[model samples]
Target: LLSDGRAQGYVLNDDIFVFLGRGKIAGLPVMVWILILTAVAVHILLKYTDIGRNLYAIGGNDTAARLAGININKYLIAVYALIGTVA
Candidate 1:
């Protein structure tokens, strides 16, 4: 709407509210839904991907993973840094 300039003619309020059962859709509920979906997506990726498996292995046994030719501690720090960035 804003890109098309329709929004420029209107004065929009910046308040957020949560509505019950059959009320209007508001900003707060929409923001909550977006956060919840993002969390779920990250959880799924961490639990199911090959990188996630390697990460868990590194967490469980750094020395063994190093022997297996994995850069154990470096990747661990990388993963932590990535999570920090996302947060």
Candidate 2:
């Protein structure tokens, strides 16, 4: 709705150019750092969190996860939303 049904994207201004183009830190581009940070965050979320355990359980068996009191619908929705965001 915010987009009003038209295409929406970055403005590609100086800040955008710097972040994705020539910007660097410690000899690595800013985008690289962003990717690394994102990866680490995801690792923590999927390795050390109760949500992660629930996700694994859901993956192994949705019915069992539901029986174990996990809200499979909410988890599945969140998982799909995350995947869509990444895509």
lDDT of 1 by residue, 23-79 (tens): 344555565666677889878877998777778778788788788888777787888
Which regions of candidate 1 deviate over 4 angstroms? 1-28
Worst 10 residues of 2 by lDDT: 10-19
* Residue 60 error, candidate 1, Å: 0.8
Error of 1 at 12 (Å): 11
Worst 10 residues of 1 by lDDT: 14-23
Model 1 TM-score, 2 decimals: 0.55
**Colliding residue pairs in candidate 1:** none
Query: What is the C-alpha lDDT profile of model 2 across 11-52, one tens digit per residue?
Result: 667786766777889999988898898889889999999999
